[model samples]
Target: MSFKNYISKLVFCNGISNSFKTFTALIINSKRYSSRFKKNTLDLNNNETFVYHLKSGKNKFKFYLRTFKGDIDIFYEVFWRKTYDRHLSFLKKEPVIIVDLGAHIGMTSVYLALKYPHSKIYAIEASSENFELLKVNTEAFKNITCIHAAAYFEDGMINFGNNELSYNQMISENGDPVKALSIETLMRTHDLSHIDLIKIDIEGGETELLSRNNSWLKLVDHTIIEIHTPYTPSDLRDDIQPYGFEIKSEKDSVLFAAKK
Candidate 1:
């Protein structure tokens, strides 16, 4: 990590809470920093792999990190700092049902599990490596179901690209073929009658998925999607409006749509 990134992390850690700040300070003060924790800093960076055991609020997480492309900073930014959804108050279901596309290593899945303890989360990842880690990371959560398949408009096989940054993996004609499942098929296979929220971050595949026959979306109450503008047109809001959803675009390509 750069000097700026390191300092930013320290600031983020300090901002968590007085108790957490004190605990983090002890780690930094100890000369055994290298021994106590895996070196996640750029200076002592390990290219192969490392693990970060983190505690935020009342939730604990174990992240398996890789040096080549994964961004460890996202954990602090998204979960700890609440950069993605600051309020963490989007879903309002009693027993929430969430479909997480592009679950990656299950960070978001774990976040949802912690926030909504009674919720059922289906975490789907396309890449085999990411799916393996997804299962490992989420195995302890009985409410979380990890699937090694792509979410598309139809049931079939499509080419998928595996990237070192787990989030960047997407469907590409030049990549290897992988099984694809539609939203209806997933809901049917899992026996979900009504979906509270559908969180989509499937790179550019959102275009095709949202453009297709989305009759199944009537059962969904809300949706959070990250639109890839380069690969998809901005008129997706129009596409969803007809489905009785009111759309609001947020920073970082995120769109929030609630049922009207």
Candidate 2:
């Protein structure tokens, strides 16, 4: 086999060398940077995007994505470069209440803070490891309040099943071991009446969370959820019609919805 094919077989099958993955990632990032450099040099228009620096490790530096239309987080460059107009269309003028459920590492919070400067964002993350990074990442944004709790259908603390590094946010429905509170109760406790955008990514708990509280529909306007129903037993949209939400868009495992 070819040299590249040999490397792929070793990395894909045996999976012993993380160095292979790191080298591949570096190559991909190099291409992306090259493309960005070419675009910035060529596009000398009135509405050009400028990059900003972020407070992260050398590998993951945050940036300010500035175009003629508006400014957003640089970490969201992929989202902005691909469907910048589509995302911008969702921007609302009125003061919005954003609920970022399962806000892994505060990407959505940081993006929302830059996207909607006047909005109030409550970012909930369960994993202790991720919460640590989320805190530092979102510290500069004053409009955001980071809550380190796993949201669920009930209130109380619960034990989280430790699994893969990314799946650390998954929790039980009732919320024991992992600190959790229902959306309805969270609203009442915080004295929040209107929710402009509620983004939920609680593994496969979307069905249970919605089924338990039909009244939550009245409080939420828009929702972006990551559904994790890969195999049987955990169909993401099995009984979601009662919640009064229409799926607007979906890519990979994430679904965007608007209350109808």
Say which candidate scores most in lDDT.
1
- What is the model-wide C-alpha lDDT for candidate 2? 0.60
Error of 1 at 175 (Å): 1.3
Candidate 1 residue-wise lDDT, 152-248, digit = tens: 9999999997533546788887778899999999999989999888888898888888888778878888887878966443576767778898764
Q: Candidate 1: how large is its RMSD?
A: 5.7
Clashing pairs in 1: 1-42
**Candidate 1 TM-score versus the reference:** 0.80
Best by the TM-score measure: 1
What digit string (tens of lDDT, one per residue) describes model 2 on residues 37-143?
55664232333333333332222333322232212222333232332234335545543899988877776777667667789999988877667667777777889
TM-score of 2: 0.64
